[model samples]
Each structure stands twice: as C-alpha cells, then as structure tokens.
Target: MLKKSLISVLCLSLLVPAVSLAETATHAVKPLTAHQERMKTCNADAKGKKGEERKAFMKSCLKGESAAAVKKAPEAKKHEKKTAKKPKTYKKLNSQQMRMKTCNVEAKGKKGAERKAFMKSCLSNK
Candidate 1:
C-alpha cells in the first residue's frame, strides 16, 4: 500500500509540472494585439532611420497618426526648430588672439599709451 501511494505521489508531481508547462506554452504563442502589430511593423519600417527621424516615425506610428500629420503638428515643428538651432561654436583662439582678448577686456577704458603699456605687461607676463 505504501509503495502504491509513493508511486502515485511521484506521478502526480510530474503530471503537475507537465500540465503547467503546456499551459505556459499555449499562452506564449498568443496572437499580437493591433497596437503590438503596428509597433512591430513600424519598428521594421524604421530600421534605416535614426535620431529625430526614427523618433518621429515611432511616435506617429504608435499613435495611429499619419507621417504628414506628425510633420504638420506644432509640437513636432517646434522640436525640429529647437534641434535646428544648434549653438554656435567659435574657432579656438591662438596665443596672440587670446592675449589680445584678455588685454582688451582689462584695458577697456584706458587711452592709447596706458592701454599699450598694460597690454605689453599682460602679454609679457603670459
């Protein structure tokens, strides 16, 4: 009787795991929802795009909005304008240019000779 009960317990434990695994497998193969399908398609379509282009594509695709609509949207236009306005970077100054800039600031109100003397001292000190 004990041997029969032990064998039954073992079989039950094995069966429980097999049944759970089968359930999980069925659920794992679930069909994609409409939104998920659209996202997948859009991601595939956006493979070649990058940066703002990819961002805009994904945003419009997920929202079910058209590309033209995204382009015409005020917020999207603002984003484009903001991205367009990159900060200007000045060219690096050489030693003479750098010294001149410093001396000019320091000698802002000084007259010719005084400015010349201050500039000479500043440039020499550097």
Candidate 2:
C-alpha cells in the first residue's frame, strides 16, 4: 500500500507543471476594439512631423480637438524654441541601396519591408 501511495504522489507531481501550463494557455486573448484598430492606421511616420503641420495632421487624423483641450496647451514660443544643434551625419550609401531603403521605409506593409524602410530612412536621413 505504501509503494502504491508513493507512485501516486510521483504521478501527481509530474502532472502539476502540465496542469499549470494548460491553465495558463487557456487565457482568452481579447481582440482590439474599433477605435484601437483605427488608431493603428495613423501614420507611425507622423512622429517625424512637427509644428503646425504636426498639429494639423494629428488633429485631422485623430478628429478635431475641443476648446478646453486647446486652452490647456502650452504657449507656442515654448514649442518653437529651436536649438542650433548640429545636424546628424549618416554613413554614405550607394544610390541604388539608398533608393531601396527609402522605398521600403515609406511603403505600407508589416514586418521586414517596414523595418528595412524605417532603418533606411533613419540611416540615410542622418
């Protein structure tokens, strides 16, 4: 009887990890809401814009902002303070590669093309 009980205990111990893993794997993954899905289409490239253009684009793309929202905003002078920081330098690339990278970054797609394009833009723009 003792041997049988020991075998049962060992079997239960072996099952514990599997049981926990199964439980963890069963969690429901909620899908994105409509608003979130819409926001995802907003140009990730918009981060590259600034000033009135940025405001205009964001306002139009995100829908109009309220008066109260504008009132809480910081003054324009504070926003316009430009430092004479030296421009970034980039490693020189051959023309063909540069074009490929440029096209890739700006092209709409998931994964490799998007990443390559973003990198190309960043590197070439530097």
Candidate 3:
C-alpha cells in the first residue's frame, strides 16, 4: 500500500509541471509599440530639468515643436563647501621597527612566559 501511494504522489508531481508548461506555450506576448517608445524618450528628457524649464520643454516636445522656445537656466547648486581639515598621515613601521618595539616591550621586566602571554594578548586584542 505504501509503495502504490508513493508512486501516485510521484506521478502527480510530474504531471503538474507538464500541464502548466503546455498552457504557457499556447499564449502570446505583446511587445511595446513605437508610440510608447517615443513617450518614454520624452519622459526621460523632462526628468532632469526643473520647474518652468521642465514644463516648457515638455509642452514643446508634446506639441511636436522644436526645443528652441524653452529658456534653459543655470543648474541649481547642490554641493556644500567642506570646512573640515584633512586627517594627517603617519609613516608605517617597517619589519625592523616592529621587532625593536617588541624587544623593548619585552625588556621592560617581563620574563619569557609573561612576554609570550603579553604578546598573545596584544595581538588577540587588536
């Protein structure tokens, strides 16, 4: 009984996808026509211009007239002057400098095991 039930379930799963695919194959998709493409171009052009310039440009474009009638003004200023000072750069420690620093820190009265533990803790903290 369990074998028959499992076979039926497997058959149903296979049939469902086949039926959906067959239905989709018979349907047709419509593409966007020339008029829609022209309107998309006009909308893109009007989006960058502001207020009166935008309105005048859209009106002239829509009426099939040239863009000469639209008076284009200078773009509005959007950026602010940064008054903050630039951060200072320091020279990086070379391999020799790093070794000297490690030796100096270890020499400040720490024994071998304590020095190892301190170095491990410093690296892990970083």
Candidate 4:
C-alpha cells in the first residue's frame, strides 16, 4: 500500500505540471482589469524607449493623460539618487579620556559642589 501510494503521489505531481503547461500554451492570459489592460497597452507602446524616457512614456500612456507627450523633464528631480549614510566618525580615546567621559556621564544632573565631589570620587576609582 505504501509503495502504491508513493507512486500515485509522484505521478500526480508530474501530471499536474504537464497539464498546466499545456493549458498555458493553448491560451494567453488576458488582462482582466482596466488597470492591467492599460499597463499592457502602455508597455507595448513604450517599445524602443529606454530608461527615463520609457518611464515617462509609460506613465502618460497608461493614464491617457498625454500619449503624444513622450518628453523628458530635465529639472523634474523625479529620480533622486539615494546616498548611503556615512557611519559616525568617533575620536579614538585613551583609557584616561574614556574614564573621564564615563565619570562625567555618571555625574549628570548634580549641581555645583555636589557634582564636583562626585566627579572627584568617580575619577579617583579604578
């Protein structure tokens, strides 16, 4: 029974894909929605157009806004080049400098003599 069931499952998996390919080959997938149809038409019309020119043509063609206006706007700033943020540069600190920085942070919000005393104690500790 195990062998038979395994054979049947394998057969089904192979058969299903063959049937799918045959169906696809026989029938073209037509655009069902208005937007999809417009996209299809625009893509066909935008043939031979490259880069931003193709993009502008496709946008105008899809909206039916200005099908004949396949012009590129030089100053439109449509494509902004995103620059990767530079990592924050930190000054390398010696042990004493690091200790002082930590002490200063620990002594935050204290006033006048109290702050001065806390800094003195914090700086004195190993």
TM-score to true structure, per model: 0.45, 0.28, 0.32, 0.37
Residue lDDT tens for model 2, 1-126 = 999999999999999999998887776466778767646654563576678655655555665455444333434434545634567999899987777667665665647876766766655663
lDDT tens digits, residues 11-72, model 4? 99999999999899877765369998888888888788888777777777776866435454
Ranking by lDDT, best first? 1, 4, 3, 2
Please give the lDDT score at residue 40 for candidate 2. Answer: 67
Judge candidate 4 against the unseen true structure and give its global Cα lDDT, from 0 to 1.
0.79
Off by over 4 Å in 4: 1-31, 72-126
For model 2, the superposed segments whose C-alpha errors exceed 4 Å read 32-72, 76-126
Looking at model 2, which ten-residue stretch has the lowest summed lDDT?
68-77
lDDT tens per residue, model 3, 1-126: 999999999999999999999888766455567767767777797887877667667666766665554433212211222444568998999876686677667657877998777766654542
lDDT of 2: 0.64
Residue 103 Cα positional deviation in candidate 4, in Å, after optimal superposition:
24
* Candidate ranking (TM-score, best to worst): 1, 4, 3, 2
lDDT of each model, Cα atoms only?
0.84, 0.64, 0.67, 0.79
Q: Compared to the true structure, candidate 4 yields what TM-score? A: 0.37
For TM-score, candidate 2 versus 4, the one ahead is 4
Look at candidate 4 and give me any clashing residue pairs: none
Residue 2's lDDT in candidate 3: 100
lDDT of candidate model 1 versus the reference: 0.84
Give lDDT: candidate 2, residue 49.
67
| lDDT for residue 74 in candidate 4, whole number 0-100 | 20
